[model samples]
Target: MAFAVTSSTAIRSSLSTPLEQPKAAQVGAFQPSDRHHLPPAAVNFSRRRCAVKPLNAEPKRNDSIVPSAATFFASEVVEKIDVEDYGKLAKDLGNASPLEIMDKALEKFGNDIAIAFSGAEDVALIEYASLTGRPFRVFSLDTGRLNPETYRFFDEVEKHYKIRIEYMFPDASEVQDLVRNKGLFSFYEDGHQECCRVRKVRPLRRALKGLRAWITGQRKDQSPGTRSEVPVVQVDPVFEGLDGGIGSLVKWNPVANVKGTDVWSFLRAMNVPVNWLHAKGYISIGCEPCTRAVLPGQHEREGRWWWEDAKAKECGLHKGNIKEQNSNGGVHANATVQEADLFNTNCVVNLSRPGIENLLKLKSRNEPWLVVLYAPWCRFCQGMEQSYVEVAEKLTGSGVKIAKFRADGEEKPFAQQELQLGSFPTILFFPKNSSRPVKLSI
Candidate 1:
C-alpha cells in the first residue's frame, strides 16, 4: 500500500533517520557506521490488554469518537485509545465490510484524519470514503522518482474526484547529501532503506504527526510476510500522531481482510482509475528504480525490492507489521527448537537482566563483547543464527564474547527502556573500554 509524505523542511525536523554502511570489525571491536534515532520519549501504553479483541465476542465500544461528524475531531470521549474500550475497536469491526469500516473511521475522526492515497487499493479507499458522503482528506508522498504513468494517474485521480491531493516532497538537503556521498543508485548495491527513509518514511512521519488517525490501502494479499496480520483498525504500533507517541496514532486499514481479486472487482464496479503500471504486470508499485513487474501467478510483493531477501521486503512505513514470528506459527511457537538450537551455543553467552546490568557496570573490559537482543520467534533472527554462531566460533580465542539477551515476552519493556530495543535481532557492540555500545546495521 501507499504512504504519506511531507514538505522538506517539516520532514527534516521530524524525521529520525537510521544509517546503513559497511562494518570494519576487530576482535572485541567494531568501527560502527550505523546510526539510529530513538523516539523522543516513551509513550506508556496503559491497559496491557490485547489491541484486538475476539472476533466472535461482540466488542463493547463506547463512541470513542464524537457522535456527530465535525470540521475537525473535537472528541466526545477525549480518553486515550489504548485504554480498555477502544482497544477492542478493531475486532468489533473485524468482520465488517470495507465500506462499513471506512464510514466508521471517517465518522469518528472527521477532518482530523486523512487518507494516505496512492495505488489501486488506496484509490478504492477514497471511493469508499466518498460513498460515505463525508468530508475526508487525502495526502501522498512524491519521491521525485515515481513512474511517469503514476504521475498522470495522480492528476487523473484529483480531476476525477474533484479534490486537491496534498503532496509531500522529500527534504532537499537530505537527498542532496545522499546523492553526493552514495550516488543515485547506491540502494542497488547496499540496500533500499537509506534512500527510502529520505523519500517515503520520514515524510510520512511528519504527515502523521498532525493527525489523530490515518487510513491505508494495505491488504494481506498485497504482500506475503509483512501485511499478513494487518487489522482493519488498531492503535498504531509505530508512528505517533498529534496527541503524541504510541497509541496516539490510530491506523485504519479498511481493506485489511480484502483480497486482490475482490479489490479489482470493487474498483471495476465503481469505475475507479488505476495506474498504467498495473497493466504492465506491476502489481505492487513503489519508487520507480526499486519496483518491477512480476510474472503471472507471482506474488505482488515480488515486484518491490526484488533484489533483497524475502524477509526484507517491507519498507519502514509498516515496520510494525514485521511481526517477530516465523512462518511456522505464533510467538514462542518454536520454544523447544530454540532451547536446543537457536542461540544455545558454547561460545555465546545468554544474559539475563541482572547479568547484563553487571556487565554494563564495568568501566573497562578485558575484551569487547557483541550482544544481540533478540526474540526467538523472529524469522530474521532465526535466519542469522548460523552466521552468528560462525562468528562466535571464529572469535573464541580472540577474547571476544558473543552474547544474546532474550527480549521477548514480558521482558520487552525492560529491553526497550534500558537496551534501546525496538525490534527483534538488535545487534549492539559493547566496546572494550566503555559500557556504551554502538548498534550495527546488518
Candidate 2:
C-alpha cells in the first residue's frame, strides 16, 4: 500500500503516446500472474528498461534522473502498507514492472487530496494531477512578502487547471506584531527560526489544522537538508494542533523523489504555466525578496538568502515537528534536538583579532549599521544565509558597515543586556552615541 493518486483511463490515454511503447493489450501478451513474475535476472533487465522509460509509455525526462513510476511506488511502499504485505511487496516490487507499482500506490492513496504548491517543482505534481485526473487541493502561503511573480503564477495555475487554489495566510496579528517590531525581512535580521515561527510555521500550522494529509511538491534532490528517506504517511508534529489534539496531521510527499528537470519537462509538455521569476533562473520560488537563481553546478537552493552566515535553507514548513513537552514548563519547539536540554546552539568560532570590535564600535559611531545575530545549527538560519550573503555583498565596502554576532555564552549576556536583543540575528542599526538601536526592516 502506498499513498498516490490513481490515474484514470483518460489520463493514461493522454500520456500513452509519449510513452511510445507497445499498446497495453499488445504488452499484455507478456503479462505473468503470480508465476508470471519475472526471474531476478529478467526483473533486472525489465527494470533497467523501465528505468530508462516507462514500460507502457515513453518517459518524460528532467535533469538528474528520469523517474519511472517504479521509484515513486518504491518510496511509498513502507509508509502506506501493512508490515505483513511489506516483505512480499518489496520482493514483488524489486521484480515486478514499474507500471504495476505505480498503479498499486495510486490505488491505495486515492485521488482526492491536496498538493502543496510553492510555485517551484510543485508544477510537476500539478502535471501529475492533470494527467491522472486526480483532483487535488492546490494551496500556497500568502506570506505577504512573496514576489509579484509568485502571485502571477498562482493566477496562471488557476487558468491552467481550471480549479481554485486555496490560499493560506499567516495570522494577521502575529504577522503585524512580528513585522512591526522586527521589520519585513526580520527573518534575515532576527535569525530565521523566530522569523519562520512567526511567518511560516505558525501560519502553516494554522492552515493545515483541518486537513488529514498534505502533498508537498518537495523533492529529496532539493538539498541536503531534505535528504531523509521520505515516507508517504508520516506524522507532522508542527501541525499537531491541526489534529484537534490527537494524531492530528499526516504528510505525504508525493514528489519526494522527483527530480527538478523531470518537473520542468512535465510542465512544458502539459503546457503548464510557470512564473517569469523562473526564467530569470530562480528554481526554488518563495518570498521574492528572499530568493534568487542559482549558478551553474550550484545546489538548487544555493541562490536563496546567499548573503547569510548560517546554512539553514528551510522556511519551517518542511521541517519535521519541533514541539517537545518541556519538563520545565512550556513546550520547546525545536525541530531537531540531539539530546534533552542540549538545544543545538549556533555559535561563531571567533579567531578574528580583538581590535576588530573597536573598529566595529568606531564604525557604529557614524550611521546605524544593521547587524544579524545567528547560530549555525538552526535550519531557518541556514535557509536565510544565502539571501543574507547577497545583501552583504551588495552592501560591501558601503557605509552601512554590516557585521555578525553569535548569540551564546558571554556574548549572549552582553547582547541581552546591552542590545536588549531577545532573538537570534537581531538586525539592529547602531546609531552614534545612542543606547537604542534603530531596527531596519528586512
Candidate 3:
C-alpha cells in the first residue's frame, strides 16, 4: 500500500482545500508544521522531552541476547527456541494488541530480532519496541532508488528514536550487471519483479542472515489480495535461518491484524518520525521511480506498480507463497523453457524486421491484431511467454491474429517509433479501422 499516515477521511476532506505551504527547512529536517493534521499525541510528544538516549551513550548488552549462527559462529552459544513454541505463542497472542505482540516477540528474540522498518506502520513498531525498554535491531533496505526525502526521514527517525538503523544495500556486482545489461530504467520497460529481486529481495535476504527473528509492519488490510492471510508470526518458508537449524528464522508481523487507522493513531500518539513523502500523499513508499502519491479515494496499492495488474502487484519479497498463474490455466513458480518454446511455436507468430512493417501495413487494410513486443533478456517477458501463447491459442480460430515481436532485436527501431515502447514486454492492440494501437494493461 502507499505509505502515508493521514486517514482517508482527512485526506479526502483536505483535497478540496489548498495545502498549507511547508516552511523552508534543511533537507531531511523535520518541520513542526508537518504535524498540523495529526492527532494530539503527536503534538504532545513533539513538545516534550522524549526518554531516548543519544547513540554514543552505549547501553550494556543484555546477557539473554542470542546471536544467529553467522554472527556467533558457535552452535552452543545460544539455546534454540522451538518453532512449535513460537506457534503456541502466536496462538496465545492471536487476540493481543500490537504492542503486546511486540513485547512478547522482543522477549523471545531479544537482540536477535530486527524490525523491518520501511513505512509508517514500521515506525509504530519501533515505538512499541522502544516502550518495552528492550534491546532490539532495526534495518531498512536502501535500494539506491529511494527518494531524497526518504534519506532525510531516515536521519529523522534515528535522531528521534536514538537508534542506529542498519541500511542494507544490494550487492554491487549484481547491480552493476543488471544496469549494464538493461540500463537504469529497465523496470519501466519491463515489470518491477526482476528489479525488486535485485534491489530489495536479495538485500533483505542478506540482512536476515544473521538474525533469528525479524519484525515487519505488515497488516491484513494493506493489500487484501496479497497480504490478507498474513499471520502474526510464522516460520518463514521462503527464507532459511542462520544455520539451517530448527527455529533459526522466525518472522513476526506484530500489527498483522491492526487496521491502518490504528497504526496512524499509534504513530501520532508516540510522535514517531515518519517520511515527509507521507505528507505529500505517498502511502506505501518504496523506490522513487515506482512510488507516487495516490488520489484521495484510490486504494493504497494503486500507488505502487501502477502499470501492472493487481495480481502482479507484489515485488517477490512477500510473494514466496503466491502461485504463479500460467497462461495454460496451470499454476507453478516457473515454466520450463521447453514448454514456453512449444507454446510459442504452436500459437504465437514470431515477427522479424520485415514482419513488423508488414503488420503495420495491415493497419491500412483495417485488420486488427494483438502483438507482444518483448526483449529476450527480460525475465518478465520470459515468464509471460507461455501465458501469451495460451492467450493466442484461445483466439486462434476467433478471426484475430496473435503475434510476438522481439523489441530488443529486429523490431527495435519500429518499437521505438511506432510502438513507443517504454518498458520491456509491451503489449498493444491494433483495432480494425484504426491507425493507432492502444497499449493493453497486463
Please name the candidate that would achieve the greatest lDDT relative to the true structure. Answer: 1
Ranking by lDDT: 1, 3, 2
Q: Which model, 1 or 3, shows the larger lDDT?
A: 1
Give the worst 10-residue stretch by lDDT in candidate 2: 24-33
Total backbone collisions, model 2? 33
Model 1: lowest-lDDT 10 consecutive positions: 24-33
Error of 1 at 69 (Å): 17
lDDT of 1 by residue, 1-442 (tens): 1112222321221011222222311111011112223333333322211121112222232212111111211122222332324547788988999999998887666555788886445789888877776566678888998888788787777656655566777778879977998899999987787788678876777777766788999887776445667788876766766666455667889999999899889987876677778878888788889989999988888888999877677666776654544347753321222223255556799898898887778888777778889876565565455456656755667667789988887889988887878787788777788767767665
lDDT of 3: 0.61
Put down candidate 2 lDDT per residue, 276-314, tens digits, no spaces: 777778887777667888888887778776666323566
| TM-score versus the correct structure, for each prediction | 0.62, 0.51, 0.58
The weakest ten consecutive residues by lDDT in model 3 span 68-77
* Angstrom error at residue 123, model 3: 0.8
Displacement of the residue 331 alpha carbon in candidate 2, Å: 25
Report the C-alpha displacement of residue 36, candidate 3, in angstroms: 50
Tens digit per residue, CA lDDT, model 3, 188-275 = 8777766887788767766765555788888878876557667788766455344432234678989999988788887776666677
Model 1 global lDDT (CA atoms, 0 to 1): 0.66
